[model samples]
Target chain A: MSARDAVLGAVKAALGRSRPADPADPAAVAAEALALLADPDAVRPALPGTDAAVAFAARVVSPKVGATLDRVEALADLPGAVRRYLDGQGLPHLLALQPDPALQGLDWAGFELRDAALPDEAAAFGLARWGIAETGSLVFHSGPDTAVLGHFLPLHHIAAVRASTILPHLEDYAAVCGAAPRNANLITGASGTTDIEGSYVRGAHGPRFLHVLLVAD
Target chain B: MGTVFKRDVARALSDATLKTAIDRTTVTAERKRAAALTDYPQFAAARERGTRIKDHVVAHLDHYLLEFERNATASGATVHWAADSEEACRIVLGICRGAGARRVTRSKSMLGEEIGLPHALEAAGIERVETDLAEHIVQLAGETPSHIIWPALHKTREQVSALFKASHRDPHKTEDVEAMVESARRELRDRFLSAEVGISGANFLVADSGAVCTVTNEGNAELTTTPPRVHIVTAGIEKLVPSLAHAFVLLRLLVRSATGADLTQYTTFHCGPKRPGDLDGPQEFHIVLVDNGRSRMLADAGLREMLRCIRCGACMNHCVVYRQIGGHAYGATYPGPMGAVLTPALQGAEKARDLPHACTLNGRCQEVCPVGIPLPALLRGWRDRSWKDGLVPQSVRSGLWLWRFAAERPRLYHLGTAAAVRAMRLFRRGGWIGRMPLAGAWTRYRDFPAPAGRTFMEQLRDRERGR
Candidate 1:
């Protein structure tokens, strides 16, 4: 086939046709695009603030959310808040997986703890640093100090997220990386499988419930 | 030659049952993700971090993967290296056989799909059950995944209900998602407990601690990894990060990009086999690292960035064409922008010649990509490669030559444009073109709005004289 025929064939395959007019007026196309943007269903709308985000979360995550997974603005002492929450839960026998230096001097006396140790089969909790976030997800990276099983092997998981480390768009994340890395994952949520007849099951290979400890110092 | 991808996609789209199923499922995920990412400034930064970490990792992949192997082995976890899909499959199967595993539960892993591992396992008298909600549907129906995030999006509730009735021990006919979920949960719970071995894919493998990270919304990955005596993690070679701190950088970008989640309900990390002090964990842990064609991707600077992808499927979700055509059309394990570049590059030019050119060259995929891969540039590169390799039809080369000739001469270009305008005007009816000779396929479903008289340049010239 001639090059023209090849291009046409490819175009035909793409459009399922022979020849497509490559639009006439560029400005008119832009105008049409702008008009399409007006439709609520056409383009994604701009993000709302804390209240709006909470409302959206309520709609999607749970309509009857009580308190444990509540939304709060960036806190000054996030690690402390996490410690306090764990203390209140009456379960502070934690096996911290990948705690950062930012959490160096937090005091937890009355509770038996394994700070950044290998996840024991009986570890109450496996704490690790998250690599990504979206819709309240805490990502975990596997390595020597932290076992891939650490995040899942433990009954409870607490992820320490620095508030400053968030992005609005996936494309923005791509821009930051610029190229493929040796290893990385963009986790939106915890380990889940819908393998059984499309049923959504949580904590299949990892944790059953995920709690994000947003630490902003 | 059969345009395998085109044929499959056409079959899928034409199948009303599949189209409805896909549309319903993808629409829901798209909306939920939009809501989750909205109003979160941190999401933007996380995505940037994810991109940067992957870029750095890919640039120094040999260093990182070797580092990971050393660290993971030190942690008492066996790490097997595979240079290609075949090697990867062999290594995994060998481990399964060594452990004397008969049945295995798997969380959703696209890499597994790419290598066709399940079929290979089944041939060896091993039953591999897909434990992901969407994956189960496709596996039951004996169909390929229609979308990246929501594999069974192409199936309707009614169809799923029927499938559940046949498959579930006690199935209900209700369309209620909760009821359906409960039914599936009960069935899978048994499989999770009974299975001797579990297989999973890693989102990232941290080198510092010898950990494998699997992130999901359903929590099936945890069950697949634990409970079972032996847990096997199969991941691409590129899924290695330097440290846990580095893993954090990528997490911020992955979840929001994949499903717009701040954090999935279960983001578990697994280090190795169950320790002596552990209660209920796998006794044997093995990680199978599959290189496939990633090494080739890493060697080339222009295409290496594609490896940084977190497999979030954001590009596919946001793509106008993909949203319309769906995943099966790509005819590869991957089905969107990333697939278009990666599949052809990994598999070869002959297998996926149509994929690269089957796009509108829109920048939406690039716009939403979490790892900053220049998809259009990469797609164009594939097209160039296909042409050079003689994979493209003779007609295409001739067309390009003619177009190039016309482009170099102002007179021919203007004349051609004028002719096009005239031809388009002839097809006008009711302010739109219902059907045209060559572009019949597009007009079959959607009408093309007719252009105003004269081209933009012509109008501009006229305006210069105050028309």
Candidate 2:
């Protein structure tokens, strides 16, 4: 028997089942999975009001999460907001722009931009599909348009989140993303570590800063 | 007591630096966890919800494991099953060899440490770099991880600086944390870009979504798995949750309990390798389901509750005994209250007989446990089993027998207790015992106060006569 058979057999034996699963009937396992997921909402934690985008912003910029936010009035103003953030932080105009239509399609003038983030790039921009109020998380889906490195390669990761996409709780993330993408990256704040001497050091490997461009629809 | 654990504890106690590190980190972590929980009152309900999900998953392990296999396979990922650590290592090594990988990068995987994956890769002539800062520090120093969450929790900043100096051969600043972190990033940035394979431990395996969810504070897990050609996730069979929704419940509680943070900086749900037109991601994705001793744990209903552990390290943080000796004294892949029960359960009762005795039976670990595993009760159960298996040392067994003999005879019990109190008083100076025989372990850390030189019966009789 294969290792799979032995493992499943061991589990079956522990559960007091008579035999290993039939090789041909693979759907039986999928059926079992669907049954368990049937009540996915059976258990949920209480959350803030559904219209708590302001609360979400509060949590995001809290000292513990340590992320800064910028709210824009329209999609067209995103580039200007990014530029404003860069100028405020004393960063340069050169930044890596994620190769997505929603971002790349924007008319980015006056700023030197690369299609994808370079290893040594100082800043990069991407779009979050949803914002979680419970944890102040940005949900990004990975696909042909979404370059996974755009989130990790740069020192400063600038994300554009639609104000209308904010959800009250973390559970809303699965409902929105649906687990269909290749990967769902839910980042809560700037990267940090206390591994050296139990002292917090920001920007360990990922970006030191996560500045959000909360665009109002 | 297990001889190995006893000697390890004795050796660990002398390292004053280890004690200080453990004291500071555990206190800080516990305070942060408390503060984080207070900030989110729903955390109380969330932990209960997490327990419900995990309990269901553990009861129906076979169904979810098979379901996970089917969905992952459909998503263009391969799922391998390993009944033991050796099998797990062989499968990972086979993947590396198939990719013709010369260098590999791995994130912090307690399962990897349990299965000795890094050593297996090294013995195969592969250069494996641990991407997590704590992991890198220990790997560079040629040492095993001292803590599950913080591997180099025992090492001081100077020690880490020394280790980096020896390995990187750089004059990185010793006092500045950022300079040291920057040095590591500079050295590892190229390795992450060039490595052929990346290995990570799964925080949760979603059967419905066919995703392996990983939680990281530093985002090293994403960098480790994303940039490589082959991404291998080795997780225990018990890591499975039914769907992403259930995983969210546990994720909220886990981050708060572990780091005292609202959420980890990065929590990525990876469903497959790379999609058909993805610009960047590992081309090959594999999930190895390991069942080293979990099947046995499942077979025993009483022991099965432990499979619900999220590896939060909260139990260890609150454990008084863990605060003193730290993780190394347990001398196992896991340590503290969780390790005391888990080491013997996974390995055997005879192999780690001393571990169960190491805990003080305080209910703090269980109180703080997110999954509510009844850790003290489990340790006590192990102690009872140790007695029956004759795993308890002969000296302890004889001592218990003598105490039981006197207890059955009430007259002798009173006489024996009265004599012992008088003898204890002889060693007292200023109402405190400077030294006590056969209780050296108790007094070694603190002074023992002298008891009144009388039994409870004598004291009661005198009080009644005076009245």
Against the true structure, whose DockQ is highest? 2
Which candidate wins on lDDT?
Answer: 2
lDDT of model 1, residue B334: 91
> Against the hidden reference, what TM-scores do the models get?
0.72, 0.96
**C-alpha root-mean-square deviation, each candidate:** 13.1, 2.5
Q: Provide the TM-score of chain A alone for each candidate, in the order shown.
A: 0.53, 0.87
Per residue, candidate 2 scores C-alpha lDDT tens digits across A1-217 of: 8888888888888887766653324366445544544443343434445466886888789886789998998888889999999999899899888777887777799899887788878999988889988788998888888887889889999998988998877766777676468888998998899787567899888999999888888
lDDT of each: 0.64, 0.85
lDDT of 1 by residue, A1-217 (tens): 5322332233233323233443224355334323322322111223445443333333323421111342334443444555666666675545453433344344544445554433223333333343222233333443333344445444455555544554443323434542222122333434454433334555444444445554433
Backbone collision count in every prediction? Answer: 128, 1
Residue lDDT tens for model 2, B17-103: 988888767788889899988777666566776787788788678878877898999998999999899999999999999999999
Model 1 TM-score on a 0 to 1 scale: 0.72
Docking class of 2: medium
